[model samples]
Target: MFTSTERIKPDAQTIALYLENVLSHKYQIPTFQRDVVWEKENVKKLWDSIYKFYPLGSILVWKTNTKLESHREIGGIKLADNFHSHEYQYILDGQQRTTFLLTSIYGNKIANKKNFNPTLYIDLTIELTNVTDDISYAKRFLFWDEIDDRDGQIQANTGKKKPLQR
Candidate 1:
């Protein structure tokens, strides 16, 4: 059997842009797909791999006319309401990675096991240090509430706090 498939290797920024489009209802996730289930640690590791230019693996989408009830919000971003189309690309895989990317970059909250939504934040301070190799890179992920106090604590412990570059 012969099939036509296209493979694209887009940079992180481009991927982010596409996700923004998804939020806008330009694409849809079929109801059959699982909900976002990546834990906080997993989300952080995904970002770390991307930051290091490590391949996170390819996303699989199916182009079809099938329209199903899709997510109204993903990772706490309120998507446009029930905008349907005759043509849709159903996300068959990479749901977790896509959710993490959307939530982390857009500063959206994710649902925890207790059903509480917590906002995600990347420690800009830690990311900067790692990028410059000024200190041993330790993967750090923080929630919105902990960011302010945690930065100081990290500095005190590591003695490697530097101003974040613009």
Candidate 2:
């Protein structure tokens, strides 16, 4: 039986490293788990939350000696064939978050809508800050392809509108 003492509070970098080097490449995705389907906005928000040091809830993993058929690739990342071992950590929850973190940080591609994979890019132009009296910070999700079009679209959408008079 598993115990709660195995839980760890690893930092984002450590988590990313573990996913990229150990989990994704070495481990297998259980057959019962669903495919990653997190929206781009959700992924962006997750990154923003991480950037602001917000607490992203812990992920639960099960340690088991039993082996099952595993995924060869996750979120478009290729994995090396790893033989089944005596001990393995099977993810019980938070697969989406973990996949997003890996794809966003390590520059892996995620499946897109048009049968193609696209890389997730964080918009660095907007700065994140905690205003002393304000409750919200600026954050935007923009793909590399959309960066050039954002300004044009912004102007087109906001330029024609006039402020209401008092």
Candidate 3:
């Protein structure tokens, strides 16, 4: 009976937070949500694009208090919206981006991939070799570090590969 509120943000670390807070997060993927079937290749592509400074698009999530059906084998975990206050469906228009960030960057246990470890981390160094954001901060994208260089520089062979707005 409540109107759903949607939050928007570019490819972010949001996915990691969502999974980490799974079962107890402020929002939940409805049963009607599609199955998480993205393979490692898809995930790899996403991370690669992101590191390239390309726009992975924004992730859309609905937040409400209404319960809904859940998919089977929901990512190697039980599908029960344990909390009543938070109920919603993850309309994953950007599933590729979400999954990669969560599983590869944050090291979150991705659906069906318990053995995978996050390969990316924030390089907390302002001194850059190829930073183009002009923001002095680098994301240290590990997606293609070998190819793009991960020496604490903001390289866009991964998530933010798209051209800059300016």
The TM-score, computed over Cα atoms with residue i paired to residue i, of candidate 1 is 0.67
Single out the weakest 10-residue window by summed lDDT for candidate 3.
138-147
Residues 9-123, candidate 1: write the lDDT tens digits.
3335467677867677665666777777777667666766766777788777766777777776666766557666777776678777877778666655655444433445556
lDDT of 2 by residue, 1-166 (tens): 5366544534354565667554445555676888777776677667667766678887666667887766666666765556557887666677788777776656666554444233454555565454441222223554444444344342222333332234
- Superposing all C-alpha atoms, what RMSD in Å does each candidate have to the true structure? 6.5, 8.1, 10.4
* lDDT by candidate, in order shown: 0.61, 0.59, 0.49
Clashing pairs in 1: none
TM-score per candidate, chains pooled:
0.67, 0.67, 0.46
Which stretch of 10 consecutive residues in model 1 shows the poorest summed lDDT?
A: 155-164
Q: In candidate 2, which residue pairs get closer than 3 Å at backbone N, Cα or C atoms, i.e. clash? A: none
TM-score of 3: 0.46
Full candidate order by lDDT, most accurate first: 1, 2, 3
**Per-residue accuracy of model 3 over 1-166 as CA lDDT, tens digit each:** 4343334333455544656655334434555555566765566556545555676666676554656654423333344445444546554464445445545643445555555444554454434455454332223333333223447445555764433345
